[model samples]
Target: MFQDNLTDLLENVQNGALSITDAVSRLKTLPFEDLGYAKVDHHRSIRNGFPEVIYCEGKTTDQIRGIFLVLMRSENNILATRASSENFAGVRQIAPNAVYYQQARCIVVNPVKKNQDANHYIAVVTAGTSDIPVAEEAAVTAETFGNHVERIYDVGVAGLHRLLAQLDRLRKADVVIVVAGMEGALASVVGGLVEHPVLAVPTSVGYGASLHGIAALLTMLNSCASGISVVNIDNGFGAAYSASLIIKEIMNGCQE
Candidate 1:
């Protein structure tokens, strides 16, 4: 349960509306739930603002389904990343309401309406069309985390004017996620321009010289721009997660 839900339950018990035994029974799964192959972390939403996300890369269909089943009992919004279409199809059998994102290769199950708090916005930019998959991954991941996301695609530095045109939107974002491959110079350029934090995601979308994104990764890591931060090659999820934290900090104005 979330803090508000737990507080309400406690108050109900104190007022004699609920028996202590019943309350204790309800909260028996507060910490976690054992599912043989996995232990679903039900208390994540209580500790963090968001619920736990499933990473479907290395999991079998049955394993994913079992873990998802336990998490669904908690009744929080669910997100699973790096899920294949087949995985989503299996999950959909269990969660009919789940939606699969083809471009991002992610799945989302929303039993409750999402709280679209757009007071804060995150901008996701891509250097070229080839980098769109990673860019979409970052954009969708950020949106799943409850942040309004704006996407600016195919604005590589080769055409500096295209990127310049969106300077106003870039400046307005609470945090910016720049996704690029090849030389991966877009992050440095964006970092130099925007006052907000810039998350650099290098994808494996380049020629042999690119060394499967290692060259771009090194370039981004050595960026002279002060505000640019780098994630692993093609790790859009990591960049999005970091951007979410920055946006949340700016929105809540809390430091910890």
Candidate 2:
């Protein structure tokens, strides 16, 4: 839609059919659409380089469908996080091409085109098998944004050798996202090993003594490793979004 609008504006100017003031007026309204219930920000793509993401957890099925239809009319790609199968069913009524990733709990419509950065990817590492769901959420989020993602699962501190063996792969990433529960020591460990930025995600995967991830969250916040940074508890989506920004900057730098 952005391309279409630009083409139309340039053609009208060449044909002398519309003045510059009229073009500016149309472009001004392109920034946003007021749906009464929700004021959708279409300018996000111009500002942030990505369209607005739909967070489907609190919204009703009808509301989600309405927003989805609005965005679908303009963009080729769309993403919805923390969505259930029922929410996906609602979205499919408007976007039949939508796909639901069960483990990631994410829905994607018309996934973005991949770039040449598949080899220069983001790495998502998990401390244990139980943390894979959160890890998968991070992985899918990164992939949907057109970043290639490599997943390294079950390499927690419990087995030092398993993590050590994957050092070569971890070092190759542009950025890393570590998902762990319990002690959350995996983030510090990976941070110490990799030269890239590490985004730690604390999951609510531990027992009562783990305080439903508070212990792990605090441990990550106090990481001894210099490059380690922490996101909110069980917030795989947030971690991935940060990683995507870093990856985009790195790629842009390389292109320059």
Candidate 3:
């Protein structure tokens, strides 16, 4: 339950539309729900403005299914990351409403009526073709959280002109997530040009000295450009989540 949901519930009670016992029963799972294998945070949306997301890696099919079932009951949007095709098929079988994002290895289900007009837009930029999987992960994660996303792929530092040409589009976004590997210089270059926040993600797509993305991570962290932040190696989901938060803050600020 989010703050709005809880406030509305309380208002209903005070107005005598709902009995006190019934309201209490509905809020019994305000903080969390304990399922033997996992502690589901049902009240995360109430506290954080977004629901708890499920990490599918290293989890069995049954555990994911159980968690998914309980989470769906709350009408909160569902997100499962690092899920395999087989797992997606299983989830689809159980919840036909869920949609699978193959490239990102994610599954999302929307219980609420779709919000056709998205409030904010995010631009996802990638350094090269090899970095697409990570880029796709960031794109899907942001979209799952209700942000409209525009993709700019294979515009790495190797071809600076290509990225320069998109400056107008980049400047229009609420937030920009730059996915890169190798030396990870693209994020710095993008950060220098755009006024919005840039989320840099380093992928494990470089040669031996790349240290499986350490070089990129370090490069991004040491970026001289302002407004650039780096997430862990291959952590596209984390970058997306952070970007979404930044965008949401800007959106809320605009309303004020």
Candidate 4:
């Protein structure tokens, strides 16, 4: 439940079709719910245009389940990033429909259907096969938020021909997410070729000098290409969120 639901609820109140007590029962979960350890923000959908997402990294399984149940009250799409199989089990006990993407380490419950009228799509490109996990994180996150995502994998700078082969498809995207490790040169290469915004994600998939992706992060930060934005090391979710925001703004602008 979001903007439209709120509007409909108010209309029902005004029309006297629903009793005040009954409406109150449905509205109890409006602002948020406090569960000792966490306060689930159900109203985030109204404010951010999307519901609050669960990050199941350090939290206990029970905590994740509690939050998941609270968010489910809103009946909106729910995303849990950095989730493990154990985390999925906790959520699944409550929401049997929850689907988990192992490569992404993310879970989606009640995913919203994409808007078929969307005018543009986002491209998720990875430098190597090893970087596919990070790329999947970005791809799945974008899809969860109801954006069209095109994935191009194993196109590192080591083989510039591979990247060039996908240039035409990359050029058509409204937003491009380049996921890479090692030197992280793929972001710069893709950024130079695309006219749209390019969000870079540096994964922790490299050798000694890579410094657990710090080297790749620095390389992306120092990229020479224009229209390029870099997120944290191994932060696929950040890249997806940034790309989603850019795509949303572009779509909103097109509608106007």
lDDT of each residue in 1-256, candidate 2, tens digit only: 5557767887997899989888766665563666778777776766677778888888998888888888887776688888899999988987888999999999999866777476789999999999998998899888888888989999999998999999999999989999999989999999999899999999998999899999999999998899998999989989988999898888888889
| Residue 37 displacement (Å), model 4 | 0.9
Misplaced by over 4 Å in model 4 are 1-31, 117-119
In candidate 2, residue 221 scores what lDDT? 95
- Lowest lDDT 10-residue stretch of candidate 1: 111-120
lDDT of 3 by residue, 71-117 (tens): 88875569998999888878876799888888888888764433523
Global local distance difference test of model 2: 0.88
All candidates' lDDT scores?
Answer: 0.86, 0.88, 0.86, 0.87
* Model 1 lDDT, residue 205, Cα: 90
Most TM-score-accurate candidate: 2
Candidate 4 lDDT over 1-256, as tens digits, reads 3556667878899999888887776665564566889877766665566678898888999999988887787665689999999999888999998999999999998767878444488899999999999999999999998898899999999999999999888999999999999999999999889899999999899999999999989999999999988999888888988888888898788779
Lowest lDDT 10-mer window, candidate 2?
A: 24-33
Candidate 4, residue 146: how far the Cα is off, in Å = 0.2
Better of 2 and 4 by TM-score: 2
Best of the candidates, lDDT: 2
